[model samples]
Target: MSAINKVLFIAPRFHTNQIGIVKALLNEGVEVEFHVLIKGPTEDYAVLTPIKIEEGKFSRFLSKFLKTQKVNKYYAFPSFFEYFNTIKNFNADLIIIRDPGRFFSIVSTIIAKLLGIKICFYTQETLEIEAKNTFRYFFQKFYKTIFHAEWITPIGGTDTRIKKFLPFVVESRFDYLNETSAIEGYSSEKAVAVIGKFTARKRLIWALKLAQEFDCKIKIIGENTTKEHATVYQELLEYVEEHNLGDNVEFMCNLSHSRTLKELSCSNFFLLTARNEPASISVLESLSVGIPVICPLECGTSSYLTPEKTGYTYRQDDYDDLKNKFRRLLVHVSEDKKIRVECLNSSAENFSEQAYINKFNYIFKRE
Candidate 1:
């Protein structure tokens, strides 16, 4: 079990980022299995989702009974026996438990511990973002203290609450593009691109407002997967009609990962208005394609942002600040031709497949 040859990831929903992770592991000759309980139709999927797992009636009922709406979309967990058997049969050298705050991760933690398996807690959460989730944040605290993993690896969280951190690595499909194509894809146009889940937290409405005010073309892409999010999506559509923004703004949904990036690649820049976004894979995806990003402060992926070089960061939830920074970024991009090169360099040094494999080695070395 001390070896790092095999790995298991148990996540609530399947994200395109996981495909990158799985491929990176496989390239290193590590056997991997991703047990997905939910296939989020709106997760900006690149390809078809994998692993069509079978869930019995009782397990599905219990999972739904304990579901929390705040996690976004519905998800289920396999029965204890199935989860236990999967871990036992895989007998992986390393178990990367993501969303340590979720019920599925909690159950997996206890089972992994009972079987004496080694685990490395992988999270995109900073404590500040966790606190936003309230009760689940508390559950994360309890889980950390009680269930004890050998290591805690986070994706670009600088929160001091965690004593030590081995950075979690991630990349996008765009990373494979040649430098010429990557640079060529960034258009001279003024259109701003926004992509992610169509939730209030993602601030699609705010992105629309900015687009309308600037009188710029906007490509808004994401899925409205839940009833709660659907309301927000409707509001976006209504705003487009009411403000006569139909000509300026375009709405898209259920786009494959490549298609999303392709759409974004042609934009002047990428805009993310979310607050407390814990290490946005979306941000890195934009950077990978040589598109500069405009995100809020505390966006974990902003670690790659170098003031006026790659992109810029605004104060979270501050629309005024966002407007001000957006103006500054546009002005700077017009003057700075080096943004594209800088963006690609940042993506390669931070979230490339090489980076993922390098950070992965640290989990085994953790004391």
Candidate 2:
């Protein structure tokens, strides 16, 4: 077998999917190193080790500006230096970067090309015509530059939309099927669970409102990131208090990934109300635990969620639709043990981690 000695992964944040990919590559005997442009402590991976590039206050301020501008040009100088230094030091064979949406990726791609390193771009969002602009022009140019040598891998339900713009080397869903075995039986509960960052776009207030109306408990697990997030959380808290839902709605902040998974295992159901999402790992993780997921049809994961079989998908931003769906799920809660088992079985077959790895290997070996 041809050897894949070293790989450098650049990403915005660490998630289970990213860790899973690194773990798989390590199992295949690849030396993996990660470079995070933004700094945050992450879950430790047994297969891969991560190295962070220390940033000065000036550079950090500039990065924030560039991120807001959607122009990655500011990161070029520092990223080029870091990439060149790392390539020379590590003698890496493959350089993998996630999401061409950032300026760091553009810089990394250029440096990799100059050093004769193989390049791979892992995309999460659909590169549709709607993204056309100065920023997208540069993104498309980079896409053309890396067209031949490496691979283009996208994870989620927007494959049809993405293929319309760029040639996809491979496609994989966000779920890891290997871990989810088809388990029988489920426990009933009076409350629902919502997980993810506490942001306005997530429409978490909607879930809170539903919980209040039905006199059911709503456990919200996530952190408030920005002022907008603080405001949203505050408003929700006030609403809960005003509507006398203090006992029914509980807020838990920033549980680690593994702990979150453990929490999902016991929840009656999962709720997601994102205004937009390419794919949500939370939904997949919930499904893996055999918890029925209730989300909007526009969410990427909705494509895989078969109503009455797997879970439910309601109309976007339609409170009536959401209320009705919640009611249906509540009514069927007593009868969902068999349904949950079927959902788990079906999800296990479709979203296995081994399947994802096989698809990745095929893309990596493409001529």
Would you list the clashing residue pairs of candidate 2? Answer: 72-103, 177-351, 177-352, 177-353, 178-353
Model 1, range 1-367, lDDT digits (tens) per residue?
Answer: 1467878887776766566677777788888877666666545433224554455467667765765756632344557787688779989777777766566676777888989877667676554555567776566566566666653544443443442354434453344445235455434454788886777778788888887887777888877677876888888899999999988898888777767777766677889988667767677778877788999878876776777777888889689989998888777766777777787787778767787676567646622
TM-score of 1: 0.83
Task: Tell how far residue 152 is off in model 1, in angstroms.
Answer: 2.8
For model 2, residues 134-188, the per-residue Cα lDDT tens digits are: 5764555567565544434333334332222112111132232224332333343
What TM-score do all the candidates reach, one by one? 0.83, 0.80
Estimate every model's Cα lDDT from 0 to 1. Answer: 0.70, 0.65
Identify the runs in model 2 with alpha carbons over 4 angstroms from their true place.
41-49, 55-79, 127-142, 145-153, 156-190, 225-228
**Model 1 stretches astray by more than 4 angstroms:** 42-68, 72-77, 127-148, 157-190, 225-230
Clashes (candidate 2): 5
Residues forming the 10-long window of minimal summed lDDT in candidate 1: 155-164
Q: CA shift at 251, candidate 2, in angstroms?
A: 1.4
